[model samples]
Target: MTQQDIRKVRQEERVAELCAGVVRAFSGERDLHFRGRRLHRGRMPLPWFAPHLHPSPETDDFESFRGVADGLALRIAGSDATLHRTLQPEEPVERMLFEMLEQFRAEALVPEAMAGMRRNLRHRHEQWSLAFHHSGLTETARGLLLYAVAQICRARVSGEQVVEETEDMLEATRFALAPRIGHALGGLRRDRFDQAAYAVHALAIARTVATMLHEAGGDDEAPDARQNDTDDKRSVFSLVAEMDREIVEQHVSAQSGRSRLLEEAGAAYRVFTTEYDREHEAATLVRRELLAELRERLDRRIAAQGVNLARLARELRALLAVPERDGWDGGQEEGRIDGRRLARLVASPAERRLFRVEREEPLADCVVSFLIDCSGSMKEHAESVAMLVDVLARALEQAGVASEVLGFTTGAWNGGRAQRDWLRAGRPAHPGRLNERCHLVFKAAGTPWRRARAPMAALLRPELFREGIDGEAVDWACTRLRARSEERKLLLVISDGSPMDSATHLANDPHYLDHHLREVLARQEQQRDIAIAGIGVGLDLSPYYSHSHVLDLAASTGNAIFREVIGLMAGRHRH
Candidate 1:
C-alpha cells in the first residue's frame, strides 16, 4: 500500500475506535461497533446515524467529530426508541420531520456542565444547515421548507439563535409555516425534557409539515427535481429518509413467508429428474483468448482496488487456523521433566527443576469453497463477483488454506430436459425441482491461483448464466468440502437473490424452491460438520442462511468487503 493510503486507513481505524467508545459509553451497549462507516449493534445496523459517523478526511477536525459523537450519545441515552417508534409518522416528509425533531430534543437536554457539548451541537447543526443550503436544496420549494423547519425546531428546543447565514433565505418559508405549526413549536420548547409530552407536539408539527408539502403538490420530487438526472449527489435529509424506507422494506421482505410447504407435515422435497444434470470445467466453456483478456481486465481492476492481500491472509489464518503441537520446549520450568536437561541441572547443582512442554501453534488446515450464483439477474454483478472471489482465493492460498471457486446455474432458461420429462409424466403435483442443474468448477482446491486465473475469469461469460437451484448447489459444495481432510471446512455462497426456477414454481408452488433451499441450509447447519455462510450482492440472504452479510459492492472498498466476508465466516454476524 502507498504511504498515503496506509495513513488514510490508520486514520479511519482511529476514528472508528473513538466512535465505538462513544457509543458504548452513551448507549451502554457494549456490542456496538463501527464496521465500514456504519455502526452495527451486533448483526443489526444502526443506520440512522451513519451520516454523522462519517467525517470528511479533507476537513479532519476532532471538535466536529466530537460534536457528532456527543449528539448521537445524547440521542441514545435521552430518547426512548419504543416511544419514538410508536409516535413515528407514516408519510415520508412527516417521518423525516418527526425524527429530526426528536434528535434535536435529545440534543437540547445536554447537561448544564457540558458547555463544550452544547457548543459542539450548535456548530454541527450550523455546518449541516450550510451544507444543505450550499447544495442547492434551499432553492427548491420542498427542500427549503424542510430546512427552515429543522432550523426553527432546533432553535426553539435548544433556545439558540437561528443560523445567521440562512436567515434571509428562510424568511419567507418561516413565515409560511408559522401559522400551521407555531402552536406545536411552542409545545416542543415547553416539554423538551419530557419525551412522552414532547412527542405529541413533535407529531403535530410533522403532520403539519407533511400536509403543507402535499398541498404544494411537489413534495415527492421537489428536492432534486432541478438537478441533472445523472448527478449522484443527494440531500442528507433525502438520504436518511431513503435509509428509513429501505430498512422497512428489508424487514417486510424477511418476514414474508416462503416455508409453508416445508412446514407441512410429511411433505418431502423431490426432484423431477436428474438425467439432464451436468458438471464441467468453467475454462472449457470460453475461448482461450477471451479468457486471457478477461483475466487481464480483472487483474487491472483488482490492482486498482489496492487490497492488502497479505494482511487479509494473516487475518483469515488467525480465524481459521487450528492448534497443533509442533515441537517441545525444554528448560528448568514447571512442565514435564526433560531427560536432555538433566545433565545441565546436575552441573548447575542449583537448578532443581527441568521440564519439557509441548508447544502448540496455529496451523491453517482449512478449506473454503466460493459458490457463485450465475443467474440471469446476477449478470450485472458478474465482474464484481469474479474479482471478489478471485482475490479471496489468492489470499486463502497464501494463508496455506485450500480454496475452490465454483458456480451453479441452469442448463437452459426456464427448464430444459427436466421440464420436458415432467410434462411427459403428466405434470405430477408437488414436483420439487423442474430445472436442469448445471455446476461449474472455475478452480479446484488443489490448483494454484495463478494457473487457474484464466478459468476463474470465465465468470464474466454471460451465456453461462441462467436459473439458479441453490439447494442442490449447496449440497454439492458441502459434499466436496466434507471429502477434504482439512480440519475446518467453509462454504461461502454469493448470490443476489433467492432460488428462482420458473418451471418449478409453475409446476408445483411459488415457494417450492425457496422452501427447499431453507431446508437444505437447516439440515447442513444441524450436521455441524462444515461451516456455511452467505454474502448477498446488494441484497439480504438472511432468509436462507443463518449466518449472512449484505455487501454493497459499489459503495464499499475491496478491503472493507473482504473484512466483512471474513467476519461472516468467523461467525461475527449471525442472524
Candidate 2:
C-alpha cells in the first residue's frame, strides 16, 4: 500500500479503538466497530459497525465522536432491556418515519448521557433544518410535511420556536399521527430501542399520513395506492435521499458565493502570515563573521557615549550576588548554638561555642529574549535597532545574564498561501501587505553576543523585510523562554507598529490578527510568569502591550535607545 494509505488505515484504526473504548465505558457495547470515515453518512447507532461519520472541518472530531458514542451507548444500553431486533419495512415512508423518530430519540437521550452533547446535538438539528429549508424541495407536499416535522422536532428538543405554518401543519396532522408519534416517543423516552416497536409506529404514522392526503384530495381510495397514484406514493426513504442530495449541492454553491463575498470585503491591501523555520542544522546560530563590522561600529558608538554599559553590568552582578553562610564559631551571635557546642559546654564549663548564622542571597539568574520586527515598515529604524540589540546583548553577556536576539518578517510579498489561492481564482491583487512568516534567529540563548554579531548584521539587508506576524512571534519567543533555567525571563519586542498582515485581514475580519495577539499574550500571562515589554521604534505600542515604551529613532541615537531599554528592563523589577 502507499505510505499515505497506510497512514490513513492507522488513523482509522486508532479512531476506531478510541471510539470502541468510549462505547464500552458509556454503553457496554462490544459488537460495535468502525467502518470508515465517511462524513456524509453521519453517526450511525446500528447493531453492527457501519461507516462511522467524520466531523466537519470546523468541529472537534474527537469530541463529536465521543458524543456519537454516548448516543450509541444509550441505544446499546436500551437494547439490553428492550431486546431490539432489526425491523425491515417494505415501504419507504415507513422507513423514513422510523429513522426520523429514532434520530429524534437519540438526540433527546444523548444529552442525558453526555451533557456536552446537548449543544452539539442542537446545532446538528438546526443545521439539518437549515439544509432542508434551502434544499428547494418545499414545493412538494411530502417535503412540506417533512420540513414541518423537522421544525417541530427541533423545537421539541431544543426549545426553539416554530413558525405559524409549522404549528398549523402540526395541528392538522396531530389528530391522525399523534398516537403513533407519542407511542414511539414514549417507548424511546423510557430508553427502549426495539426496532419492531418503532416499525409498527412508523407503519401507523405512514398510513395516517397517506389517509390524510387522500381525504384532503377528496379521493376515496385505499391507503395502499399505486406508486403513480399520488405524490405521496414516493417512499419516505427516496424522499429523504433526494432531500439530502439537494442539501449538499445547495450548501456547496452557497459556500462558493460566501467565499467571493469575503474576498470583496477587505481593502485593496492583502496581508498574510506563513510559518517559516530557519532552524534545520544551526537555526539559532548567528554567524559571528557576518556581524563583525556592524558590531565594531556599534561598540565604538556606545564607548563614545560614556554611559559605560560594562559598569551597569557590574552593578547588576552585585545586585544578583548571594551571600555565603558561615557555620557556628566562637562568636557572640545571639542565636541558638550547635548541638555539639551545647554538648561540649555540658562537659566543660569553659567550653565556648557560638550559634551559626545562615544567609541566602538571590541568584542573578535571568534570561532575556529580544524579538525584533524586520517588516518593511521597520527598514528606516533597522540599523539603530540592530545597534541597540548589540550593546544590550553585550552588556547582558558581561553581567552573565543569558540573552537571545531574534527577528521576524515574511518570506513572500503578497505571495502566501492565501494570496496564491486568491490569485488562482482570477481575483484582483490586493496591495499593501506581506505574506508568509519567516523567522530568523540572530542569536540563541547561552550563545555569547560577540559570536552572533554576523547573524545580527543580517538585519541591515532590506530584502529580509516582508511583513510582521507579531502574535506568533511573541508566542515563539515565550516558548523559548519557558525552556530556559533562569528564574526571571523577560521578552523584549522591538516593533515599528502594530501587527499588520494584510491578507489575513482581507480573508477574515480586520481585527483577526489583533485579537489573536491579545489572546496569545493573555494565555502566556496566565500560564507563565514571564516579563514582556515593547519598545516601539517610531510608534505607540500601548494597545498591544501593558508595559510599552515609545521611542523616536530619529530623535535618539543608539546609546540613548539602549539606555531606555535598560531602564525598561530595570523597571520590571520595580515594586
Q: Model 2, 296: alpha-carbon shift in Å?
A: 3.3
Q: Write the per-residue lDDT of candidate 2 for residues 39-70, one digit (tens) a residue.
A: 11112324321111223322235555555555
TM-score of 2: 0.45
Report the error of model 2 at residue 35, Å: 56
lDDT value, candidate 1, whole model: 0.78
Q: What's the true lDDT of residue 326 in model 2?
A: 41
**Model 1, 1-575: lDDT tens per residue?**
23344344445445656866876787797776654445566545674742333445444376666777788788888988888888887765667778888988899999999898899887777766676677676776766777788889888999999999888887899888888989999999899989999999999998887666554534456575644422222343463354334434433122224656667899888887889999999999999999999889888889988899999999988888888899987774788889887898768988966888899988998899999999898998898888899999999988889999999999998788888888898877777788889999999998999899889999999999999988999999999898899978899999878888899888777887877887788889888888888787755566567666767666568599889889888866644
Instruction: Evaluate residue 6 in candidate 2 and report its C-alpha lDDT on the 0 to 100 scale.
Output: 31
Instruction: State the displacement of the C-alpha of residue 554, model 2, in Å, after optimal TM-score superposition.
Output: 5.1
Instruction: Estimate every model's Cα lDDT from 0 to 1.
Output: 0.78, 0.56
